[model samples]
Target: MTGKTHIVGGIAASLAYAQIGNHDPLIMLGAGIIGALLPDICHGGSKIGRKLPLLSKLINMLFGHRTLTHSLLFLVIVAWLLNSFIPNEAVKAGILAGMVSHYLLDMATKNGIKLLFPIQMTVRFPLTTKTGSKVESIVFSLLTLVSFYYGFESLGYYL
Candidate 1:
């Protein structure tokens, strides 16, 4: 999935999380976006990857794409780190929501991610699509609408 799609998924997840958790929509959205792009750090062409070219290259070379960074272990470690370092529950939840969204989106791709890394297990959905394909674009658009609707709905509660 593209970064934009991940971002939309993250926002949608944030909105969904906001419905059940006590958090500011804006903060959740911001954290969610960051989390969504975090997993793609191994791909040099990704949004976050482009920003840190050297780190991205190193990760890509050392681990390859969709390996350690996209694994459940990575998510667990990240969650642990966030829990230990961040005092805000809502913030941690929002970030985790985004990361989970990232994983789900990648799971829909043809080349599924090694969700359980070091175990050589790939978790994928029944239906899959190619990355950056027209189908993904449609998914991106639909998720955008969903995100907008939910985002507005979520904001109404705080407003």
Candidate 2:
């Protein structure tokens, strides 16, 4: 999936977290976006990778794309870090949700992700689509709608 789609998914995940946890919308959104982009840091050509080229290149050389970063181990470590250091439960929830959403979306791609890394297992949905294709566009659109709907629902809590 494209970064745009991941971003939308991040926002939607954050909005859901906000609604559930009564979190600060901006903080959740920011953290969620970071979470969503974190996995692709291994891919030097990816959007986040382009921004942080050196680090991305190092990661790409070391672990390669869709390896450690896309794995459940990575998510567990992130969640552990968030839970250990971040006192704000809502922000932590938002980030975790965003990260999980990233993996879930990637699972829909033709090249499935290694959800359980080091275990040598790739997980994917039955309906796989190519990245940057029409199916991805539809996914992006649907995520946008979900983001708006949940964002409004989150705002309702403020009102």
Candidate 3:
């Protein structure tokens, strides 16, 4: 997915986490952003993509695009890895929230995500916006709107 889609997915995922429980907004947003782009680490030229070529390529070869790395299982593993460093429930939640949102947004695209991964099940929405579609811009704009609203609404008084 593109950056805009990732941002939209991040916002939506963070919002979902906020709705579920009380936590720090910044932390949640951070996680969402990380998750949005985590899967693309296999793009062969991304920051992480370049660092872990073998792992990324292996994942890509085994699952194909938007498959294993986009699944709930993938999210959980990422959460576990993050928890090791953060060692906080809130942070772990944020990481998972972001990854799930990433996967969901991919599902909304034309190619869609193979959410079931190794199972070979393809999950897609009825209407896809196409990769790099205008929906990316519109969705990202809305995400920014929400972020500004909540970012300040929640953080302003504290600051």
C-alpha RMSD for every candidate? 1.2, 1.3, 2.5
Task: Please report the candidate that would top lDDT against the real structure.
Answer: 1
- For 1-159, candidate 3 gives per-residue lDDT tens digits of 576667667766775676467777777777767766787765666545677899878877866667778777787777778867877666677667777777777787888876776777788889778766788677777767876776665564356
Candidate 1 lands at a TM-score of 0.94
Pairs in steric clash, model 2: none
Residue-wise C-alpha lDDT for candidate 1, range 41-108, written one tens digit per residue: 99999999999999999999998999898999999999999999999877888888899999999999
* Superposed Cα RMSD, model 2: 1.3
Query: TM-score of the candidate numbered 3?
Result: 0.82
Residue 136's lDDT within candidate 1 is: 98
Off by over 4 Å in 2: none
Between candidates 1 and 3, name the one with more favorable lDDT: 1
Please give, for residues 1-159, the per-residue lDDT of candidate 2 as tens digits. 999999899988888878778888778888889888889999987889999999999988988888899999999999999888999877788788889889999999989898989877888999999999999999999999988898777776667
Top of the candidates by TM-score: 1
Assess each prediction's global lDDT (C-alpha) against the native: 0.90, 0.88, 0.71
lDDT for 56 (candidate 2): 97
* Pairs with backbone N, CA or C atoms under 3 Å apart (clashes), candidate 1: none
